[model samples]
Target: MLDSQSILNVLRPVQDPELQKSLVDLNMIRNVTVTDGHVSFTLVLTTPACPLREFIVEDCEKAVKTLPGVESVAVDVTAETPQQRSLPDRQGISGVKNIIAVTSGKGGVGKSTVAVNVAVALAQSGAKVGLIDADIYGPNAPMMLGLSAAQVKVQQSGQSEVLEPAFNFGVRLASMGFLIDPDQPVIWRGPMLNGIIRQFLYQVDWGELDYLIVDMPPGTGDAQLTLAQAVPMSGAVIVTTPQNVALMDARRGLRMFQQMQVPVLGIVENMSYFIPPDMPDKQYDIFGSGGGQRTSEELGLPLLGCIPLEMMLRQGGDRGIPIVVEYPDSASAKALTSIAQQIAARVSVLALA
Candidate 1:
């Protein structure tokens, strides 16, 4: 008979590509209703930014179509992000399902750029996203996120002050840039960094975020340690350039996370090559190549993606607009989006495990 039971029975063999399990078993397929000859159901994904959404839906459709009397199939798609497993000594943000740290061992590897665009891409995919500029010393996320002059408001909640984050490009941002003067430099000692990082993580009104992307300053220092010890992280993405020095730093950063018992999701190689706008057909590997892949292979971590250097990418950042939003068709933008999807997929798998 053409019923919900048969529909689910067919879909039982159709598994989530990433999780390698039945969608039905995962309880991702739900709300079945049959009418006339039409069969419809909901496909609830683990993350909104699932890279293979189309393929999963297609598989569901094909599976349902094989039923003896099914005339048509309709799958309404939705997502529910899972919470990361908490560590014994670490506390989780109340409404945040996952916390992702985007960092590097050394400076100037486009770590902030990756963090910002990844947050924007997740938001674009209908995920509730937040970004914390944990780069306390040089808080550029405000400028890059188009909130250069934006101020974060503080509201009294009980006895403590809670910060209200600035929002743009679908990603809410909490940064030292929003709290400090534009020309002023944060010259605090190492001991003082912990308070500010914790405040950014816990004292902000994140309000039910699926992913909170923390953009950490370069190096494995106080800020990185404070965060790992303070909260349960979904994973860390080490950003690097296609250079030996950057790769060396990335290794140190990855090891730090592993030692702290935080999952190192993968590595992101930015500025892998230069794609000159004037010469659309030409490519230049100014920073060298394959370093990220080699490092990932050597270290046994995933090489999430490689973003090409493009003039427009910097311009977009300077213009307070992300490449993913301003020039979605650009190569860098596409790479960033794919990396965001990969991060989300990894987070889901980790959460499920």
Candidate 2:
């Protein structure tokens, strides 16, 4: 018969799929028993409806079966309640905090880029901030924050656990991209998407954040609904290009937030114009002009700022260095910084009121 210690040694290779930590390290392996070449154990999961439970169980079984003299492996999975899953007496983020959602009607309007820079800028302003890449289908906050492909270490407290979000540019971040391969698509339905959003809110160790900026996916879809229902957002920032098509989409995005009773913070016009470095004064309206300003005015919202169409912005995003950080003195960078300050001021006023 395999000794309990020997069985544990074999089982050490088993990992919780979602948590991505060894069962042994997570302290999830419980009630290990060995008798007559039969090994039995309990696997405590973070959630009762944990989607990866079956995989974890199979992995545990396979690992134990590899041990000499192990004839049968019995694995039972159990889940902890949300309260039980959290550290003891730990309070969640307070109500005084603001949760802002940065969204767009369509993609490619630099929504994620704006989200990343805004979060970092807020952090730079000394507010304890966190960023959630709630765009399940296209999680780019990890990449924008220079944390793409980074794995966060999950810690356990008795029967509870918490995910440690990765940090970059002085802001804490959580993204679906971090949990799955970048090439793999998140083909999840509404319910599954809701669960994922909740997990990010309650399972991650986002301690004492003054603001949590959620980078929402484009469109008025299940992801947006999930965020509206799961968290009380202070406001939403709509990103759009200075074009009619983008403005139409921005209108839909703004209306969705308003319908959900989330405040429309303002509109940010991206790729507003292009100014070649050689001729700084010569400005070309690449995507046309005044769409963002018009949309904001029509929606009765503020035109927060306009981000120029610049190669550095794209290059910075691709390289995990936001233009705001890489070229703070540039016109576009300074514009974003000023926008960041304006957002901070607006949120601060709301907090006071």
Measured by lDDT, the strongest candidate is: 1
What are the lDDT scores of the predictions, listed in order?
A: 0.87, 0.78
- RMSD to the true structure for each prediction, in A, is 17.0, 14.6
Instruction: After superposing candidate 1 on the true structure, give the runs of residues whose Cα lies further than 4 Å from its correct spot.
Output: 1-88
Best by TM-score: 1
Put down candidate 1 lDDT per residue, 1-353, tens digits, no spaces: 88888888989999767445567755678899889879999997655776889999999999888877788999999875333322446788999999999999888889999999999999999999999999878888888999998867899999999999899989999998877666665565356788988898889999999999999998877688788888989899999888888867887787567645688999999999999999966889997889999999987899999999999999999899999999999999999999999999999998888
Candidate 2 Cα misplacement greater than 4 A, ranges: 1-92, 189-191
For each candidate, give its TM-score against the true structure.
Answer: 0.75, 0.71
Q: What digit string (tens of lDDT, one per residue) describes model 2 on residues 1-353?
A: 47878888888877655333456755578789998988888887655776767878888888887777888989887865422533322223553288888888887788888889988888888888899998877788888889986889888956768889999898999888877766665564345787888888888888888889888887877677667656666778888888888867876676455444466789999889998877877889977899988998887888889988877888898999988888887778888888888787777776676
Alpha carbon RMSD to native, model 2:
14.6
Error of 1 at 282 (Å): 1.2
TM-score of 2: 0.71
